[model samples]
Target: MRNKIKKWMRKVCFPISVTVCLLMIGMTVKAQESTSVKKGIFAGDIDLSGMSEAEARQAVTDYVEGLKETEITLLASGDTEVAVTAGDLGITWANPELVSEALEVGTRGNVIERYKVLKDLEHDNLVYPIQISFNLQMISDILLEKCVQYDVQAVDATLTRENGEFQVVEGKTGYTLDVETSIDKVNKFLTEEWDHTACTIALDVDVTEPRGKAEELAQVKDVLGTFTTSYASSGSNRSQNVSNGANLINGTLLYPGDEFSAYESVAPFTKANGYYMAGSYMNGKVVDSLGGGICQVSTTLYNAVLLAELEVTERFNHSMIVTYVDPSADAAIAEGSKDFKFVNNLEYPVYIEGSTSNKHITFTIYGKETRASDREVRYESKVLEVNQPPADIIYPDPGQPIGYIVYDSAHVGYKAQLWKVVLEGGKEVSRTQVNSSSYKMVPRSATVGTATADPAAYEEIMAAIGTGSVDHVKNVIAILTAQAQAPVESPEIGDE
Candidate 1:
């Protein structure tokens, strides 16, 4: 019985000892993996086997930094190409946390499971793909700064008048980059398709065709509307300004659906732009200002546009009544505030021919005539209310002699409406209210002299000015003049 028991104990002890040794070996392997990544692991083709977390992170960082110099060629319209590096687009490592994930691999789960994963990685290495990040806006700005200059701009066909005939100047097509779409394409290629090396990308491009042709512009021979205004009363400077503004607007070509801006066509109202100091309206008063008579050019064009049956997009009435056109018939344009704009709504293009002759400025709009031969159109001004100016305004001037005075006549205010009367074969067909105007009443202004060596005369003139009456001021002037001119009486010779 003692021999049998000894044999049984020996068999049990042999198997139990082997199991304890294997458990201790497995714990030793897990402890080694806790300090560093497991063997047979990689981070984007970079082997990180048996490397510490810090070592693996550095390896991945270096890999990403090396990619910064990778060149990307951007091809744009017209055989244009721009070369850039990944650093220029703000590329950086996107997933540093992936390094930690690689370290944790085969470190989790029970001993048998961990052992199986490690064995599998021995034959098939685990790879964690390196992801990259970039600044989208940076890419966009780079493309705009480098690629925009290569884009070609489309040119619209224009018309020119020579020797009383119209000629058409052809236009050219253009090529331009589609920036937004190209940006998306670049991002997709870099993120999903690029192989961490140099590559070429074709930017999205757009084709723009020119407008109008020879046959289409040939229909602009007939005179659609013509208007003439007399600037004969204007001074030489004012007449020069009118003619200068007219020349700036001459030969302007307007295609169908194009809107013409009178102010834009003749702008930068400076001496360098052929403008002079002349009379223009300001706050219901006529003052000498630059680009003064330019309004007359716009007014004449406004009437011609009205007769042409064009669409007026914007129009403003003058602050004071002008002598060139009736009330509500004038169009006023001021710098930075007012503009006279009209659209060419006809089927064919129109040409603007402006000229100055015999102190008169005329604007003729030539286009294909579509109206009936017998049809006639005219505009009339109808007065609504008239406002009489108040008492005269007097200003004392100490610079001139006591009897000297300068005066300007008062302007009566008026409210009027313009009517567009269309007649077919000499019979009125329609009368439409075109526009309404309200002119401000400007009082008569007189600059009277109060300069006198006599204190009594100065005091008398001030008193007259306080009365706000031009007649009273004139009476004071007459009395003072008569006193000065009266013959002095000779003293009796016996008194001396």
Candidate 2:
């Protein structure tokens, strides 16, 4: 009976052993097939196994983000909803390496231990909750940035003088956000299961009382910079235009970041605009046009602004040299083609005072003087080149009597450099080149009609014009005198 039992056991044991070995081999092969962690696994209820690094990261992030939009309600006040977006309240993942940890869970220790971990992960469900906290300052910044629109900042009371007595101006009340309550609303949303989508918070306003009730304007007594230019040689129309333009700019107030436009301030230089026809440059010659001396006013203001160390935005020069200022110092303006502009870069407010006498136009700027008392500013005009004019052009007219000549103009061209010099305590501190101006030369011309009457006199006049007087206008009287003294030949051998 023992022998028979032994024989049956051997046969049954062999087959059973073969089946167990086959099952173990199959399980090992399945485990080894995947280099990464097995699937159907969860780290804190978030699936992370059997995925590439990028895929595992994405999966974990999605799970966290899904819980991020959870709504929080503020119930103390009425129903108001505030959605908590990502990065609000300084939202961030505590353990960002969770995916790496999940990958390593079944990978550490001995083979048996690793296999046991993998088996446990495959069989059981696990949830790992990460620690999330709010950053007080960062969250406050974000919340305040949004709340500023609802809250109005408190403004200080202003003072102004009117009717020779100081008047009281009522101060305005302002509103602000209750920061503590607002932060509470955000915390409740993050802590509780977001069921209600609305949150309510009331804005708290605080009264901002003014220091002084007089409401008197700031005492503006300092003269920041002032400039004056004489226009005594100007015609009646030109003088009117200058005065009109100056009047428009006078008593003008400018706050910070404000810009001044010469053309825009004084618009429509027509008869209706109190501007009359004056002599202005049309092409190359002077003609009767509207707003002739307006440019002079702008030029004067521009120089004053420069002296005050104000910022000049746009400026242009005339085609021909102006008689009022030096070459590059003058600022020319037309309605649409040209303009003069300056910006009020000072911290305090500024006012422009413009007044014109019959002899001069002046631009005085008033603002808080910030510069030192010892500092002085001046400009120097340096001549770089002298451009000689072209040859004289003579036009003969038969209507004129003998030896009659008209001298039109003598314009000398120049190339000059203007430097703005700053001095402190009689020492040169700095120098800035403002502009390089080029003036076009106008050639000297004379209409000598003596040739129609006397041949000898014509030769003498031509001889006088050709001599050493080639560069500039010289000896006009001498040439006329020489022509007068020339002897006329007798009406000789004409067989009449």
- How many clashes in each candidate? 0, 11
- For each candidate, what is the lDDT? 0.90, 0.69
Give a tens-digit lDDT track for model 2, residues 351-410.
688889867999988767889999999988888988787766665545764456665465
lDDT of 2 at 101: 64
Maximum-TM-score candidate: 1
Judge candidate 2 against the unseen true structure and give its global Cα lDDT, from 0 to 1. 0.69
> How large an RMSD does model 2 have?
14.1
What RMSD does each model have against the real structure? 5.6, 14.1
The worst-scoring run of ten residues by lDDT in candidate 1 lies at: 25-34
Q: Model 2 clash tally?
A: 11
Q: For model 1, what is the error of residue 331's alpha carbon versus the real structure, in angstroms, after optimal superposition?
A: 1.9
Which sections of candidate 1 miss by over 4 Å? 1-39, 50-52, 76-79, 148-154, 170-185, 202-210, 213-215, 383-395, 412-415, 440-443, 454-496
